[model samples]
Target: MGKQLGFYYNSNYCIGCQACETACKNKNKLPVGIHWRQVDHFETKNENNDRQVDRYISRSCMHCKQPACAAVCPVKAFRKRPEDGIVVQDREKCIGCRACVHACPYKAVAFSNQAVKASKCDLCIDELRQGEEPACVRGCPLQVLKAGDLREMEVKGVVKECQGFLKAATGPSIRFAPEKR
Candidate 1:
């Protein structure tokens, strides 16, 4: 699982409850309006059924193969770990320049108005080191999120991008379970 650890979200089954978001906040103790992960919901026409369906999206840092956040950070505060390909932020090095926030194509990086630093999902590296799944994966009531080797997950018929998510040049590390009819 060391080549590229990434996240897979099955949007078809997600209920948009923000349980993952809450769990992340609880685990990271993030201040108000600072989100390491976020949920977005919308209504779309189900082409198969010709009826409207609610679509819920849960996303965090893509931990991209070529992360723009890391590229744009003047302090080099963002880096992708060589062992697992998890993009990590060195907060101590951050200067709150917000370049990463603007450069990230996935919009994964977050700037805290309170702390004035940039932060994003690190995929709960401490938990991974202890052999536990990320807090968001553990916290989802519907069990829609999974994290592991990116290559292995790609073999499971996942798509590189979900609705409303663009395929950027950064090669986002996230995949999505195919939508169900």
Candidate 2:
């Protein structure tokens, strides 16, 4: 891959509005029951146990370096692009076997009954090629989402993991700025 493309989310700034999810669905023309992006809200007690805290997380395909979906697909429908390292699907080659759906550790892959194929976030490659941000990133009212080179985000001290997310051993491309208590 020429560059490691990825996204970043700051939980501290998220308002749990689901605007990113809505933007993703609208931009991709997703059918009912298929959500490429989702927002999760959870509550936790502070360390002092005096008050409860709410956290909002926006989640999508991480486009991992060692993508389990790509590894498990028998037909090789999933591929990591050499230009930017975005994991994308070749729908014409897919068999609708659901192997990718099961293999993704972040549960990013989804089965589309209408199309009879596995689908997930491709990070809006078309938009990126046009020098535009992904729909989800652009749609965040709170500016909680960002897209850029993974190395750059790491250099800015983005967190690699947080609650309600899979471990980073698969080398997930997304980074988190988790809420601090």
The regions of model 1 sitting more than 4 angstroms off are none
Which regions in candidate 2 have their CA more than 4 angstroms from the true location?
A: none
TM-score per prediction, in order, is: 0.95, 0.94
lDDT of 1: 0.88
| Backbone clash count, each prediction separately | 0, 0
The 0-to-1 C-alpha lDDT of every candidate, in the order given, reads 0.88, 0.88
Q: On a 0 to 1 TM-score scale, where does candidate 1 land against the true structure?
A: 0.95
Cα lDDT tens digits, model 2, 110-151, are 898888898999999999989999999999998989998987
Give me the displacement of residue 127 in model 1, in angstroms: 0.3
